[model samples]
Target chain A: MTRIITVALIILFIITAGCALFVPMQKPVEQDNRLFLWLPGASSVQVLSDWNDWGGSVAAGGIIDPLSGRMEKDDTGLWTIDIAGLPGGVYRYAFYVNGYKWIKDPLNPETALFDGRTVSIIMFTN
Target chain B: MSTSLITLIILIAGGTDSTDVSIIPENWVFGYDCLIDASACGDWINNHPVIDSTSVDAAVSVSAVSPEVNFLVTGAMRNDSTSHVVLRRARGVVKWPGTPWIAAGVYLNDQQPFIAGLSNPVLEWGWVDIDSTKGFGVSSGGVLGFSGDYLIQLTSGDTLSQLNVHSPWMGFAGVDYSRARIHPADSEGVDITVNVLSVRGDFRYFKPWLIVAGAEGEEGKWAVSAELRELRPIDTQWGRIEIVPGMHFAGDNIDLPGSAFVPGQRIITLGAFLESRRYFVSAGIKGMLDLSSDSLSSVSASAGMISEGGITWDVIFGYYADGDYRAYVSSTVSDSYASAGIAVEIIDDSTRVTGSASYSPRDDVCAEVSFSGDIDDSLQPECVLAVTTSLGPVMCLVGIEWEYDSSPSLRMNLTGLFK
Candidate 1:
């Protein structure tokens, strides 16, 4: 712990002294408050999970809402959803493609089962 | 606090200028999202089984920064007997976007947000589904390692009220407090008030959480549950192992409004899971005890493995102390363009078997077929065929299903998204 703090302090000092060139580039990580999927060819993508009642599958009439947790597509074929302002809890989510197929988040290693389907798990904090 | 006072405060906050300076917001801003979905399905059942024929749903969500606003409106129409067209799930929220941002949530379906508990949540288990009510919520933090979300909801007749305060985490375990009171809609109805508290923390190696709740002026109107989740994982040369333990106790008259929690029960559970590091194999076993009756409640075990040839097989078995049991087994094989799987399940005195296969000729299109039947002929056999494809900016699906005693069903779906 002491070593870690000392190294952090040294790096802060170097950055403050304008010699921060020694800092190394780090690998990209998954953002805590967002979800991402890359499927440029898919026409639609929605997050079907334990939250939103599995896209309302278990609601009164068992109607599957097509836009429940809908994701946005960018020019680069990436689909993303911003889950900010969500109450902190654990949620199991999977990308529902074209209204049928379920795709788990490849970047997330933790997994859980939701109604016999494998979904990605996230520990969300406000 | 009075509802009138709350309304006045929100109105006052909204009238203030929100363009004071550059916004450092992990916050809402000028944007809009919308989608429309349409589908049709028809089924002929032996008794009376036919879909409403078609359903259409659309939603629009918009946000802005200057006078901070975020709102969503959803409407749906279905074609059927009593074909009802409704504008539901509509919610409007206005934020005073800054530190300690104030916000209000008004929704027809009461999808108001709240923080319950991470593990053994006594307040909310899955989705936030409450009675029809309008709620005011206030939230702050995600700054300086402190965050809190609070909400108060009221019904029109002032017969129902709920309050929730949740602090996710401030470099440690989280805390929660919630209260709910309701007077039945009908005359001569009883009144119930429940207060709950939950605390959960994470340790680097494992996590332990607990919850306790009680209702005022009621005998045995209380419940408590605790669990040590993700506990005791040991790594070895061959694989990894983990075990979790938990227990529950509730009073005879406890009425914890949740979808899955039993109100009159004392139960204990122990579960273990193991995964092979060098091979594609995993196994799990769980046991439950009914402490109230001092008997075994149920036990279940599952195992799965994959072979070098890319063939996967899995098995699950369950046993209950009441002399009921179930067994399931399945195997699958896949290649670049196609995959096939077969499963068998034994429940009660009958066995069921199902087989399914899918072929994806290209990245844009796929077709699938499945069939299921029972060995004892008690359940009529069923078969289904479906195809999915993408057409530029739109995706489409068509499916046909048939059974022994009913006419075939045909279904089609089309979906798209927009800014």
Candidate 2:
């Protein structure tokens, strides 16, 4: 059982790492005024953020409009939302998937807490 | 006259320190926002609601620093149909150089509930405890490596109190535990008590957050959620790939009836994505499982890219086990002077197409026009024209909207901030 667990852990690490060793490591020049999610198999994505009162959960009777902050998906299965018009300040945002799941922006590393769930933070200075 | 005399006495009692009271504070700032919006359309539709409004609000803040205490008092006023003014924040904290401190008057209280997601029982009960309220609290330097700030407050005969204990971050880990309770004014109303502890840890490979929360009001309830997130990513030629997984579970009565909490519900979330350099090419899939129902729940998929020449393109799709689906495709391009985009969305059978364009002469100003509608023979189109500009210290947005079966709505907003 111990040997089996060790082997399983190794496989998990390799899968999570995913070919980075074979290719030269690089950092993508991520966007500051946009959000990205790679979920080609999913049907919809909405950005629920402090900026929009968590997609109006309190005002909309808990049913968030699936189209709010709707990101455009391209042929490559990546979803992107343009937020260039947002004012300069600190903001917390998360990706609401399939109407129920709350996931933070993967590309941004900064995090803050709100309503018990962890969310991604972005600060813009004009 | 005697009531006014009492106020003067109280003012004299508070000015005993070496720093004497003054008529005007040494430093002050003023900020304001003003807007006027109106809509008028040809009287074709009488049932549609139009937007017309004029609003103005301003706030003044005074800050004073002395050897014994620091004071920040703010007052705000607004005018709509009527004009009114109120004291906003009267935060006077005795700094005395650190550790234990005492604060009174209108200060901010941050007592948050430990609720996750839209499960919502917590949200209904947790709400925001009190934002700028008349209260008193005492802070302690440290006790057993944890600092504490205990506070008690009263408003409208209801008593709300909190005991917050937190450990400073040690570069890798930190924890905070808070106990808050509300005693209703009514003799028969049941009191509510909430206890929550949150721990955040930063590891070499991942960051993990754990929340354990419970509350007792009408009944006792408990909830827990764990998340392992990647704060940063290392990429390869095909770009970077990331996976985020989380789990949440709660007692059936997490909130009250009519809240977002569905009884006996549990959710497991997982997502994976890959994006190329500069995110010029990317794809991702994310989904949530309904563990209580033993069902596949809902899932979504998307892919998008921006070409090197600045043309943007994207496609998104989603599906629920209940036969509901939506798909969208769009492309857009922009330059320093002009931009345009066209897109279509299909939800079930209905389809909507949208086209938009914009022009900008300088960095601080832009004007845009857009039109969209369903293409099902019976035309229902919505059109909008808007311009944004900044004049001096104030920013402005003015727009007009004309929609089928509705009167046109016009709006203008102006905002200014100075501190």
What is candidate 1's fraction of native contacts?
0.04
| Cα lDDT of model 2 by residue, B21-78, tens digit | 5653444322222222222333223665444456655544455566445566545556
DockQ of 2: 0.04
Residue B198 displacement in candidate 2 (angstroms): 1.8
- Cα lDDT of candidate 2 equals 0.58
Candidate 2 stretches greater than 4 Å from native: A1-91, A94-126, B1-52, B65-70, B99-132, B141-145, B155-157, B187-190, B217-220, B231-239, B256-262, B275-283, B294-296, B303-306, B312-315, B377-379
Worst 10 residues of 1 chain B by lDDT: B112-121
Best by the TM-score measure: 1
lDDT of 1 at A19: 30
Clashes of 2: 32
lDDT of 1 by residue, B1-419 (tens): 22443353454345343665543343544444434567889885665557857876554333344457666544444444654645545567766666666666565554433323333234442233433455566655545444555555555444556666667475658877777766666676667677877777787677676777888776988887776766656877666776868787888888765522466789888878775555555677878899777455989887665544444466778899888899988766644456688999999788999998877676557677889999884778999888887544456798888987769897888765555
